[model samples]
Every structure is written in structure tokens, then in C-alpha cells.
Target: MILFPNAKINLGLDILRRRPDGYHDIETVMIPVPWCDVLEIVPAKGSETTLTVSGRRVDCPPEKNLVMKAYRALAETVELPPVDIFLRKIIPDGAGLGGGSADAAFTLRGLNELFALGLSDSRLAEIAAGLGADCPFFIYNRPMLCTGIGTEFTPAEVSLSGLTIVIVKPPTSVPTAEAYRHTTPSIPQTPIAGIISRPISEWRGRLKNDFEPSVFPAYPSVSEIKEKMEGLGAVYTSMSGSGSSVYGLFDNDILADCLTETFAGSAVFSSKL
Candidate 1:
């Protein structure tokens, strides 16, 4: 069976408090983007699990691949037949794009369907949560208001189809742990999710991301990308998650194409979501 696991961006990420479990409590909106990774899984001959990975992020060892871990996680519950999983990765890793979490969630959903597990969406999301905090978002694959280490989800009545997004991933990588370490917990009282769901024209001063303040100063170039996108008539622009990847929203593809051409060498993607 073949399935495409899509990536997601954080609309607004706010660190609320540090929990005793070492994981910080957070309030954020996760929006699904068109950017995706292709995964193919097939029944195998042996009892042992196997995985092959390739594409934008290929440095991860096969043993460390989330698809393998996902398969094993299911194996523990059911004595599954051997499976050959191939991951054609396209999303940038560690850029706060949720590539790994999406893959794990996709595996859970796909395995349930392929093996006739007949698990409900809530059940699949439960398995996804075991894989990672962000994994549950991919189970429904929609824009959501997420909280509680990203396990909680509330659907947002938003449509970003009219806007084109310019996503740029700088060559450098920012570790999630390092990004969180640099951030101080501050809860914004603004009705974050409600504002983003409004028309794109209204997003100019309403939409906000708390991470941009601390992250931009540490990396000026990341801030510059967001600035340039807005300077080119983007209605709203913000850093997706912790750091590294920044996205700008436009009303037309003509502007999006122009921005794409300007950032040719840089890893930039133009799409509508």
C-alpha cells in the first residue's frame, strides 16, 4: 500500500509552562501544508521488520527511522507479517515541519487500513500520540488548535486556500530542545485560533507567532526571509515552529512565483493549503 504523509506548520506556538515530566506545556495552532513525504509499504517475506529511506533528509540511519519504529510498535500488539517500508522523504527534518511525526502517524493509519485493523480515527490518534506529541495532528490532517504538549486538538474553522504560501528552509538546522531552551514561557491572551480562521485580509495584524521574537534575534537571516515575504505583499508572515522554517501568505500565485524565483537556490516551496 502507498500513502503520502503531509507536513504541518505551527500557526502560533506559545510556551505556557514547564511540566515536571520535562516536557513543557504548550498552546499552538498546527496547520497542514501541502508539503509531503511519500511512503510505500508492502508485505515482506521474513519475520523481521525492514525499512528503506531516501530524499531530502537521508542522513538518518535505517534503524532509527520512524517508519521502522512505527511498524515495531504495531508488531508488539499484533503478531504482524513482515513488512517492507520505503520512505521517500520530502519535508525538511528538524525544521519544525513535523515530517517524522507525520510519517509515524501515516504508518499507524495505513497499517490499520492495510491490515484490516478497522481502528477508528480516535484509536489511530491514540497510537499516534504514543509515537510523538505532534503525531496526533496528522491523524485528522487539518488545521487545529493544539495544546497540552501538542496532544490536544480542536478543529479550526479556517480555509487558507485563497492564499499562497512561500516556505523557506535555510540550510542550517535548529534543534527543538535548543529552541525551547531559549524560549521563556509567556501566555498570550489573544484569541489566537479565532483570529487565524478569519479571512486572509484580516490576518495582517491579528495573526501572530510567539516564537518569532526569541528565534529571529538568534538567526537574523530567518527573520529576513519573513520580512522579505511581507515586503512583497504577503498578508501575513511568521515562523512556523521553533526556528529555521518561515512561511509567508499571499493572495495570488503571481506573487508567490516571483518570491520562489527570488529564493531559487534557497530551499523554498510555493504552494496553497
Candidate 2:
């Protein structure tokens, strides 16, 4: 089975509070983007499943990789044969792009289809939640208002249709632990969904990621990218999640090339919605 696992960006993130389970109750809208990684799974002729990765460095053993965890996830429930998994990782990790989670979700989906598991998306999601908080979102892979530690979702009536999106990732990566440690939880007076439902032109200063205050002072380059994007006439610009990556929504492609050149030191990607 061959699948392309795409990256996602948080439209607006609010870390409400820390839960008893050591997870945070968050409210945000997550939207899929064209940034993607390639995955291929084939039945193995040998006894054990294997994983091989190329492109961006995953920097983990095969057993520790999310794809293997995905395989084990199904193996625990249904009998699964060993398979050879090949992953081409394009999306950079620690950019808060959900690349690894997307790979895991896609693996679960790929395995289910490859083995005729016949599990519904809901069932798959139930299993996915065990792997990561955002994993379930990729099973649906659409715009959603995520709450309850980001596992629960309600369809978001948000659209970036006819817009260009540019994502820039700097070398600096803010650890998830660090981002959360410095963050103070608060309930927004205005619900993010309500703000997102308004005109895109109204999103600036209004739509915000709760992680920005902590991440910006730590990684100034990431902040610079957001500022530069805004200077380039983006309708809206914000960090995707946590830290390290910033994306801007533009009304046209006229400035896309220029934006790429301007961020030569960073990894830059541009696509149309």
C-alpha cells in the first residue's frame, strides 16, 4: 500500500489547562496542508517487519519509530503479518507540523487496508489516540475544532479556498516540554472557532497561538519569519503549533517566489489551497 501523509497547521491554538493525566486541554482548529511525506508498505517475505527511512533525519531506531508503533498497534488486536515499510520523510520534525503523527496515522490506515482489517475510521481513531493526541486528526485529515486534549473534534466551517499558504521552518526547534513549561493556561474570552469563522482579513492579532509568547523569545528567527510574512502582504500569519514553523496565507501567488528567496536559510514551502 502506498500513501502520502500530509502535514497539518494549527489555525488557532489555546492550551486551556493541564489535565490530571499530564495532558493539556487544548482548543484549536487544525487544518491539513500540502506538505507531505511518502510511505509504502509491502508484505515481507521474511519473518519480521522492517522500516527504512530517507530524506529528513528521523534520528530514532526502527522500533521507536511511530510507523512501527502503528504496526504494533494493530498487531496487538488483530493478527498481522510482517511487512517492509519504506518512508520518505519530507516534512521536518520539531516544526510542530505533525509529520510523525501523520506518518503513524497513515500507517494505521495503510495496514488496515492492506490486511483487510475492515475497521471503521472511528475504531482506527480509538486506536490512534493511544499513539498521540493529534494522531486521530489525520485519520479525518480535514479542518476541525479539536478539544479535549486535541482528541475530540467537531467539523470546523473554515476554509482557505483560493489562497496561497507559505510555511517556513527555522533550524531552531522548541521542545514540547519547554513550550508547555513556560506556557500559562487560560480560557480565551473569544472562542477560536468564532474568530476563525470571521473574514480572513480579521485574523491578524485576533487569531493567535498560545505558544507564541514562550517560543518567540526563545527562537527569534521563527518570530522574524512571521513578521516577514506579514510584511510581504499575507492576509494572516501565525506559528503552526508550539514553535519553529510559521505560515502565512496570501491572496495571490505574486509574492510566493519572493518569500521563498527571502527565507533561503530556512526550509520554505508554498502551495495553493
Candidate 3:
């Protein structure tokens, strides 16, 4: 089976408090973008499962890849046949695009179909949650208001259908752990879901990402990209998650094209939401 796992951007992220389990409580809106990675799984010839990756180069051993981990997680519950997993990665890693999490979620869905596991979405999501906090969102795969370390989700009534979204990933990485270490979690004055309910134009002043305060100071380039995007006539712009990748939402297609050309050297993607 061939599956294309899509990427997502955080509309607004807020760290509410630190949890007892070493994870932070968060409130955020996660929205899917057209950017995607391709994955294919087919029955292997031998008893051993195998993985081959291509495109944009995954920087880890194949065994440690989330696709492999997804398979292992499922294998523990059900009998499975050997399969060859192929991944073509295009989404930038550690940019808070949820590329890896999408891959893992898609793998669980694919395996259920390929092996006839007959699992429900909730069941699959339960298993996916063990892979990553963001994994469950991809299973639902739509705009969601997320809380509780980003695992809990409710459908968000948001539609960016007429807007152009431009994403840019600078040549730097923001480790999630490091970003969290620099943060001081506190509840937001205005919750992201409430902010989103207002007109997109109003989002400029009310909607905010808590990560920007600490991350922007540490990695000025990411902040600069956000500024450049706003200067280029974006209706709204923000860092997707912790750092490194920034996105601009625009009603003007011409402006989106100009921004794409401006950041050609970096991994830039422009598409309609």
C-alpha cells in the first residue's frame, strides 16, 4: 500500500503548565498542510521486515525510524507478515511540522488495512499515542484544538480555504527538549481556540505562540523569517511550533509567490489552505 502522509502547522501554541509526567500541558491548534511525504509498504520476500528510505535524507538509522517503530508497536498486539517499508521524506525534521508523527500514524493505518487488523480509529489512535503526542492528530487528520501535552483534540471549526500558506524552514534545528527547557509555562490570557474564532485579521494582535518569546531570542534567524513574512504583506505569520519553521498566511497569491521566490534557497512551500 502507498500512503502520502501530510504535514501540519500550529496556528497558535501555548504552554499552559508543567505536568507531573515530565511533559508540559499545552493548548494549540494544529492544521493540516498540503506538504507531504510518501511511504509505501509491501510484503517482503523473507521473514524479516525491512525499511528503505529516500528523499531529503532521514538522519537516523533505519531501525530507529518511526515507521519501524510503528510496525514493532503493532506487531506486539497482532500476528504480522514481513513487509518492506519504503519512505520518501520531504518534510523537514525537528521543525514542528509533525512529519515524523504523520508517518507513524499513516503506518498504523496502512498496516491495519494490509494485514486486516480491523482496528478502529480510536484504537489505532491509542496505539499511535505511544509513538508521539502528535501522532493521534494525524489519525483524526483535520483542524483540531489540542490540549494535554497535545494528545487531546477536538475538531476546530476553521477553514483557510481561500488563503495561501507559505512555509519556510531555515537551515537550523530547534530541539524540542531544548525549547522546553528554555520555557516558563503559564496559561495564556487568551486561549488559542477563542482567538481563532475571531476573524483571521484580528489574529494579528490576539493569537500568539508562547515558544516565540524564548525561541526567537535564542535563534534570531527564525524570528527574522517571521518578520520578513509579515513585512511581505502576510495577513498572519507565526513560528509553527518550537522554532526553525515559520509560516505566513496570505490572501494574496502574488505575494505568496514573491515570498516563495525570496526563500528559494531554504525549504519553502506555498499552497492554498
Of the candidates shown, which would achieve the greatest lDDT relative to the real structure?
Answer: 2
In model 3, residue pairs whose N, Cα or C atoms come closer than 3 Å (at least 3 residues apart or on different chains), thus clashing, are: none
lDDT of 1 by residue, 28-147 (tens): 888889898999888876767688887875677887777777777877777678888889989988678898889998998888888998778998788778888888899999988898
| TM-score per model over all chains | 0.93, 0.98, 0.97
Candidate 3 local lDDT, 144-172, one digit each (tens): 99999899989999999999998999989
Better of 1 and 3 by TM-score: 3
lDDT per model, in order? 0.81, 0.92, 0.91
Q: Distance from true position, residue 121, model 3, in Å?
A: 0.6
Off by over 4 Å in 1: 255-257
Q: Can you rank all candidates by TM-score, best first?
A: 2, 3, 1
- Model 2 lDDT per residue over 114-212, tens place: 889999999999999999988999999999999998999999998999999999999889899899999999999999998997999998888989999
Write down the TM-score for model 2.
Answer: 0.98
List of clashing residue pairs for candidate 2: none
Give per-candidate clash totals: 0, 0, 0
